[model samples]
Structures are given as C-alpha cells and as structure tokens.
Target: MNTPLLELQGLSVHYGSLRALGSIDLVVYPGELVTLLGSNGAGKSTTLRAISALVPAHGQILWRGGSLAGVPAHRLLKLGIGHCPEGRRVLSRQSVVENLMLGAYLRRDTAAIHTDLERCYGLFPRLAERRSQLAGALSGGEQQMLAIARALMGRPELLLLDEPDLGLAPKLVGEVMGALAQLHCEGLTLLLVEQNAEAVLEIADRGYVLEAGQLTLQGPAQELLANPSLRAAYLGG
Candidate 1:
C-alpha cells in the first residue's frame, strides 16, 4: 500500500474548555479526493484548521511519515499544504488578480506562479473575465471560485478545502463541485469538507462523516452513499 499523504492520529481540538474534535483518525492518500462530511458545528472546519496549524490541537498530523507538530501555518503552506478557508475570505479591497498572487507569496518560482495563475483563470473562466475586478464586488459564487483559484495558485500537493459550497445557488454549487472534480482528475489531492454529502460523494474516492466533533462513519464514498442509515440520516432517502 502507498504511504498516506496525510494522516491524523487521535486528533482532537479544544476551544478553552469546549472540545471541538474528539480523537478523530483519518487518512488521505496522494492523488485522491476525500470528503469530510458533517452538519453545522460538527468540527469539520476545526479539522481543516488544525491540519493547517491554524488552531491549537492535540495529537499528530503526519505528512509523508513526518510529524507536523509545532510547525507554523506558513511553513506548512511552503511544505505543500494549501487551505481554502470557509467564508471565501478573499481580500475585499484587492483586485481578483492580486488575491491570486498572494496565494503564491511563499513560492519563489515566478515562472511557475505565472503559469498557475493562467491555469486558475482557465479553471474558472469567470475569474478570467473579472481578473481585474475587486474581489468584494463579485457575487458569492464568484468569490468562492476565486478562493479555490487562490488555493490552486499555491500549487499544493494536498489541498484542504472548507465548505466551498456554502450559501450558493444550486447551479453555482454544481459549478464549484465540477471544478473540484476536474482538479482531482488533474492529479491534485483534495480534502474537501462539505455538508453537501450527495454532491461530494459522487466525486470523492473515500469519505468520513463527523457529528458534533466526533467521527461517526467512514468508508469508500460509494459505500457510504449506499449505506441505508447514512442514506436516511444525511442523504434524505
């Protein structure tokens, strides 16, 4: 078996006295798309944040057999982990192009960064159209696209996305999900967190479900999609 590209062993997170995650164990392989599914307040975002070193947490985050303990978030980005945070936190005052450029701040490869910028534009043609527009002026869906594109500009070996489909119309959700599917096909490893289980499961290789900061179920995506209880609880069967 191939070594896991990312692994969490007994991972837990606390906000003061409150536990946000409870000893969750998960693995994501290189070149695979894995989805973390859950409803609101389920620690889905906390899981991504902890892996990105954005929050204090307990246990180990292993990347390619090495522990990520005490690593700063910027260093983690340089080591090839990119995070597209929830809420489309683009720089509102900056031009769309500028936000994308910032994503490559840690890289010295000017030529490759330029190439990736163009590639991001290609992936989301609307971004190409509004490349010079201020990010705040764009619609919610467009901002989400820009957030994903910005993450792509980092050229990460493993991309961690948090709720890329939140608060968008159905059509926009399809567009965002389709772009993610394309990215995975083009050999980007993705750890996607979403409440939209049905959409993500259709594209993901494997999935893990979280409930109130604890993992409740995990399996191959299709199997989870087919499981009777899962279908009833999350899939609305």
Candidate 2:
C-alpha cells in the first residue's frame, strides 16, 4: 500500500456543548477518490471543516507524515490543500476570471498562475466563455463548475469538496461527476463530502459513512453499494 497523503486519527470536534464529530480515523492516499456520505446534520461537512482548520477540532491531523497543528486555513492553501466549500461560495460580484485569480492569491509564480487559469478554462469552457461575467449571474450548475475550477487554480495535491452536486440538474450532476472522475484518473487525490450517496459511490474507490458526528461504516465502494440495509435506508432502494 502507498503512504497516505493525509491521515486523521481520533479526530473529534464540538460546537459549544454539541459534539459534532466523535473520534474518527481516516486515511486518504494519493491518486484516490474517497467519499464521505451521510444525510443532513451528519458530520460530513464538519469533517471537511476540521481538516481545513476552519473549526476547532481535537485529534491528530497529519499531512505527509507531519502534524498540522496551528496551521491556519490560509497556510493550508499554501501547503497544497484546496477546499471548495458547500453552496459554491463564489464571489458573486466578481467576474469569473477574477474569482479564479483570487484562488491563486498565495502563489508567487505568475507564469504558473496564468497556466493554471488556462487549464481551468480548458477544463470548463463555460467558465472561459463567461470570463467577464459576474459569478452571481451564472446558473447554479455553472456556478458549481466555477467553484471547482477556482479550487483547481490552487494546484492542490489534495482537494476537499463539499456537496459538489447540491441542487444541480441530473445532467449537470453527471457532468460534474464525470469531470471529477477525469481528475481522479489524472492522479488527483480527493476527499469528497456529499449527500448524493449513489452518485458518489459510482466514482469512489472507498467510502466512509458518517452519522451524527461519528463514522458508522466504511468499506470498498462496491461492497457499500451492495449492502441491502444501506440501499433500503440511505440509498433510496
């Protein structure tokens, strides 16, 4: 087995008195796509926030075998981790190109940033066409695409995506997943948190089930897909 790019051990989080995540252990290897699935109020989103240090968390978060203690979120971006949060939080008033440029704010390599901008445009031509348009004016699906493209501009080794398929049309969802699949094939490491279990399972190599602040189950994607209880419950069988 390959060494993990990111690892979490006994990870826990709380919001005041409410325990949002119990002790959790997770490992994400390079060039793999892993999905974290659960319904509303589960700690799915919380886990991503914890990794990015957006929320106070307790436990070990190791990246490349080093501790991530005291590493602020902005520093994490420079450390090769990019997060595309839920709700496609694009700068509504900014033009598409400007939004993308903001993602590379920490980067000093101007030539590389320009190359990445072109790469993002190549990956999502709609963004290229709407380069001058305000982010808010785009449709929901288009906005989601732009969000992902913006994150890609950071050139991260590990990408954390939260609910990329939220509120998208079926065709647009398919397009988004297909794009993710292509990125995975090109050796991108992904840790995705999504409510769309079935859709995510189709592309994930393995999955972890989060339920109300704790991981309840985990296994290969195929095995999880074949689980009768999971199908009848979370999967809408």
Candidate 3:
C-alpha cells in the first residue's frame, strides 16, 4: 500500500543490435525480498545496471515515484540504492578496511560511516578477523561478504546484488546466503539475480524469471518453486 520503493515500466536496454532487455515492468515494494532468476545473458544484470544508470537505457525507471533519468550511478547511493556488481570485484590490492572506506566515498558524515563499518563487521564476523588482510587474500566466500559489506557502507535502503552466490562452494554459498537472509530480516530490501533457484527461492518472497532479455514469468517465490515447468527448466527436475 505504501509507495513502491522502485518501479520499472517498459524498461529496455540494447547493445548496438543486441537487445539486452525488452520492455519489462516490475515493482518492489518496501521491505520485500525479491529475486530475479535467469540463465546467463538473460538480461537480469542489465536490469540492475540500467536502474543504476550504468548503461544507456530507455523507458521509465522510477525511484519512489521520481524519474531516475539523468541520475548517474554514483548518485544512486544517496537515494538509498546500492549495487554489488557481478564478481567479487573487491579492490584486491587494498586492505579490507580500506576497501570498505571506498564504499562511502561520496559521503562526508564521518560518525555514521564509522558506525556502519562496525555494523558490517557484526554481520560478517570473519571480516572483522581479516580486517587488515588484502582483499585478494580472502577466499571466494569471504570476498563475497566483503562485497556486500562494502555496498552496505553506502547505507542503502534497497540492495541490488548480481550473483552474490556465484562460484562459491556449497558450504561457502550457505554462509553467504545465510548472511543475505539475515540482512533481509533486518529490513533491507533486496533485488537479487541468482542461478541457484532452489536456494534463492527459499528466502525470497517473490520472483521473476527472464529469458533472452525478456521477463517470461513472475509470481510468489513459493509458487515458482512448485511450478513443474520452472522446476524442469531451472530447478533441475
């Protein structure tokens, strides 16, 4: 009933002749955890990219009813949007603390930034242990944690994650996914893109599926999980 936190109507993206996304309409209300599911090249990432103005896009991307046109990606943070891009693109050379500092590059509130930093440490205790280590030295799962924490440093209202579980071992995936679930429980709105449908659906409230740059199906997460076709195609029937 409250104003949706984010909305995309007729959203489309193209790379020259390649149409990465074609007229997708989606909505995320406050305090909901939503999953965007698809195979590679399905334009799931493109949707998040366009929302952040990381790519040239057409149609309307509204943030709390205001047009996001002309709003650059760097500025999205102040609007309570944070993106943890694909790949644990941590500043591998930097110390973990230094990397987190970069996430707040746009802010000048020293006190709040420090508070958030400790809060991140609380979320991922391992990060606190390796706070002085180089990001490159951490394991895959650790890197993923740092990536999410870095984005949290921006203090966003809704977090857009592009494959946070990608390439992690089963055990590591559980750790990272559990952390994400915890964040959602603490009132963080999330729009996630993941290939692990079963794991994601377990924690997500709703879901949307994309195929070849178009939204093919969407509904409650439990409904999608129980769907025969979805199970056969994505959940490995």
Candidate 4:
C-alpha cells in the first residue's frame, strides 16, 4: 500500500458552544479521489474547512506524514493544498481571468502560471469563452466551474472541494461531475464533500459518511453504493 497523502485523526471543531464536528478519522492516498457524503449541516464542509485551516480544529491533520498543526489557512495553498469552498465564492466584480490569477497569488512562476491558466481554460471551455466576463454574471454552473478552475490554478497535490455540484440542473451536475472525474483520472488527489452521493460515489475510490458532525459509515465506494440502507438514505433508491 502507498503511504497516505492525507490523514485526519480525532479531528473535531466547535462554533462557540456547539460542536460542528465530532472526532473523525479519515485518510486519502496519493492520486485517489475520496468523497465525504452527508446531508446539509452534517459537517462535510466543516471537515474540508478544518483541513484548510479555515476553522479552528482540534486533533491531527497530517499531510504526507507531517503534522499540519499551527499551519495557517493562507499558507495551505502554498503548501500544495487547494480548497474550493462552498457557495462558489468568486469575486463577483473581478473578471474570470482575474479571479483565476488570484488563485496563484502566492506563486512567482509566471510562465507556469500562464500554462496552468490555459489548462484551466481547457478544462472548462465555457470559462474560456467567458474569460473576460465578470464572475457574477455567469450562471450558477459556470461560477462553480470557475471556482474549481481557480483552485486548480494553485497546482495543489491534494484538492479539497466542498459542494462543487450543489444547486444546479441535472445536466449541469453531470457536466461538473464529469470534469471532476476527468481530473481524478489525470491523477489529482481530491477530497470532495458533496450531498449528491450517488454521482460522487460512482467516481470515488472510497467514501465516508458524516451524520450530524460524526462519521456513521465508511467503505469502498462500490460497497457503499451497493448497501441497501445507504441507497435508501442517500442514493434515492
């Protein structure tokens, strides 16, 4: 087995008196796509936030066997971790290209940045078509694509994506999911948090289920997809 690229042990988070995440342990290996599935408010986003250091979390987050404690949120991208947060939080006023440029703000390699910019355009042709348009003017699906492309601009080793497919039509959902699958096939390690369990499970190597901030079930994607209870609760079977 390969050494894990990322690991979480007893990770927990609190928002004032409320615990947003109970202790949860999960692992993702290099070049693998792992999905974290749950309904709304299940701490799926919290998990990704904790890893990105967006929220104060307790316990361990190990990256390539090194402890991530005390690592500041802003530095995570420089450390080869990219986070595409929920809500497609693109700068509404900025042009699409400008938003993507901001994603590589920490990097000095101008040539490579340009290359990655073109790559992102390739990944989302619609983004290429609207490269000069204001991010806010794009449709929901287009904004989601921009958000993912912005994250990819960081050239991360492990990408943490939260709800990339939320609130879109079925056709848009399929388009977004297909892009993710392509990225995974190209060997990008992804830790995705999504409520669309069936779509994600189809591309995931493994999945962990979070229920009200605690893990309730976890296994290979195929097994989880095949489980009757999971099908009923999450897969809409």
Candidate 5:
C-alpha cells in the first residue's frame, strides 16, 4: 500500500480555553477527493485552519509523512499545500488577475506561473472576461471561481477548500460543484469542508462527519450517503 498524502493523528486545537478540535484523526490519499462534513460550529473550518497552520494546534499533522508542527501559514503554499479558505477571501479591491498574481508571489519560476494562470483562465472563462475587473465587483459565483483559480496558481498537490458553495443559489452551487468535480477528475487531491452533504458526497470518494469538534462518522461516499444517521442529519429527515 502507498503512503497517504496527508494524515492527522490525534490532532487537537484550542481557542483560548475552548477545544475546537478534539484528538481528531483523518487521512487523504493522493489523487482522492475527500470531504469533511458538519454543521455550522462543528469545527469544520477550524480543522482546515489547523491543517493550513493558520492557528495554533496540537498533535501530529503529517504531509507525506513529514511533520507540520512549527510550520507557519505562509510557508504551507511552498510545501504544495494550498488553502482556498471559506467566505471567498479574494482581495476585494484587486483585479482578478492581480489576485492570481499574489497567489504565485513566492514562486521563482515565472514561466510555470504564467502557464498556470492560463490554465486558471481556461477552467473559468468568466474569470478571463472579468480579468481586469475588481474581484469584488463580480457576482458571488464569479468570486468563488476566482478564489479557486487563485489557489490553483500555487499548483498545489493538495488543495483544501472550505464551504465552496455557501450562500449561492442552487444553479450557482451546481456550477461551482461542477468545477470542483472537473478538477477532481483531472487528478487533483482535495480535502473539502462543506455543509452540503448531498453535493459533496456526489463528488467525494470518501467523507468524514464532524460534530462539535469530534469526528463522528467516516466511510466511503456511497456508504456515508446511505447512512441513516447521516441522511437524517444532513440530507433531510
């Protein structure tokens, strides 16, 4: 068997005195699309933050078997870990292309960066059309597209996405999810944190459910989708 691309062993996180993640264990193998599902305040976002080194954490986080302790948030990108955070954190004032350029700021290889930029444009033609417009001016769906594209500029081996479909209309949600499915089919490894169990289970190979800072359930997508408890809680009673 091959080594997992990422793993969290006994992962724990705290916000002052509050425990946000409690001894969590999870894994994502190379080229697989895995999802972490939970309701709001279930610590879904905190798990991603911890993995990205955005906040202080405890326990062992291994990327390709190397420790992530003491690794700062900014350096994770260079290590092939790219985070497309929740709430579409694209620079509100910057042009779409400018935002993408920021994603590639640390790279010395200009040619590859340019190539990746074109690839991003290819993945999202709307972005190409609004390439010169302020990112905030685009519609919500477009902003989400730009967010994904910017992260792609990093050319990551593992991409962590939080709430990719939050607050979008049903149609826009399908569009964003479709884009993610396309990327996953193209062999990108992803760890997706989402509340829409129905949407992610369709694309993810496996999933883990978190509840109030603890992992509650995990299994292959099909099993999770059909799980009575999961269906009742996330799908619709």
Candidate 6:
C-alpha cells in the first residue's frame, strides 16, 4: 500500500483538566479529501490545531512515513503542510498580493513563487481583481477564498482546512466547496474539518465523526451519509 500523506496515531490533547481529544488515530492519503465531521465543542478545531503543531498535544504525527516530533509550526510550511485556519485569519492590513507573498516566506525559488502567485490569481480571480486592495475590505466569501489561496501559495502536499464554509450563505458554501474539489482534482491532499456535515460528505471520499473529542465513527462518505444516526443528527432528517 502507498504511504499516507499524513498520519496521527493515538493523539490526545488537554486543556487544563479538560481532555479535548482522547486517543485519536487518523490517516489521510495523498491527493485524497478526508472530512472530519462533528457538532459544536466536538474537538474538530482542536484536531486541526494538533496536527499543525499549533497546540501542545501527545501523539505521533507522521508525514510521509517520518516523525514530526519537535517540528515547529513555522517549519511545517516548508515541509509542505499548509494550514488555512478557522476564521479566515488573513493579514487584514496587507494587500491581497502582499498576504500571498507572506505564504511563501520560507520559499527561496523566486521564479516558482512568482509562477505560483499567478496560479493563485487564476484560481481566485476576485483576488486578482483586488490584488492591491487590503484583505479586510473583501467580502466574507472573498476573504475565505483569499485565505485558502494564500495557504496554497506555499505549495503544500497536504492542506489542513478548518471550517472553510463557516458563516457563508448556501450558494457561497457551494462555491467554496467547489474550489476545494478543484484543488483536490489538481493533486492536493486535504484534511477538512466541517460542521456542515451534509455538504462535507458530498465532497469527501471518506469521513470520521468526532464527538466530545473522541472519534465515534468513520467510514466511506456514501455509507456515512446514509447512516441513520448521522442523518438524524447532522443531515437534518
């Protein structure tokens, strides 16, 4: 079997006395879109943070069959892990183009960086149209697009997306998910955390259900979508 692009074994995290995640194991293959689904306070966000090394946690995180021990979050960018965090944390004061440049901070290939900038623009034309505009000025949907594009500027092998569809209209949600599908089609591996379970399952090949920081269920997307419990709790049955 091919090696996984990202793997987490027996991962656990705590906040003070609260156990946020309890012994979770997950594996995401190269070029596959894997969705993590859960309700509020289910530890969905914490999982992403843990994998990105943004929070202190206990586990074994392996990338391409190698350990990620003591690897700082900033260093992960160069190792091809790009995180488009929740809340679309773009540089509000910077122009769209400048924010994208920040994503390539660790890159030394000037030529490829320039090429990737154009690629980002092509993927998000609205960003290109507002390349000189401050990131704060864009609409919520546009800002989300910019956030994903900025992360893509790093040319990561795996993209960790946290609630990419949060707070957007239904139509905009489709657009955002469509963009993600496009990226996956182009060979990007994705580990997505989403509360909108129905839409997420529609695009994901497989999914895991997180509840109270524990992985309660997992299966192929189609099967999970048909699950009676998932239908009642998440699919609005």
Please give each candidate's TM-score: 0.98, 0.97, 0.97, 0.98, 0.97, 0.97
User: Which stretches of candidate 5 lie above 4 Å from their native place?
Assistant: none
Q: Cα lDDT for residue 170, model 2? A: 99
Q: The CA-based lDDT of model 2 is what?
A: 0.93
- Greater lDDT among 1 and 2 belongs to 1
Worst 10 residues of 1 by lDDT: 227-236
TM-score of 6: 0.97
Give the per-residue lDDT of model 6 (tens digit) for 1-34: 4899899999999999999999999999998999
TM-score of 1: 0.98
**lDDT against true structure, model 5:** 0.94
- Residue-level lDDT tens digits of model 5 in 1-237: 489999999999999999989999999999999999999999999999999988888899999999988989988988899999998988999999999999888888988998999988888889999999999899998999999999998889999999999988999899889989999999999999999999999999999999999999999999999999999999996
lDDT for 192 (candidate 4): 96
lDDT of 1: 0.95
TM-score of 4: 0.98
Model 6 Cα displacement at 180 (Å)?
Answer: 0.3
> Model 5 Cα displacement at 172 (Å)?
1.2
- Residues forming the 10-long window of minimal summed lDDT in candidate 4: 228-237
Where is model 3 more than 4 Å wrong at Cα?
A: none
lDDT of 1 by residue, 122-233 (tens): 8999999999999999999999999999988888999999999999999999999999999999999999999999999999999999999999999999999998988888
Question: Where does candidate 2 stray beyond 4 Å?
Answer: none
Query: Ranking under lDDT, best-scoring first?
Result: 1, 4, 3, 5, 2, 6
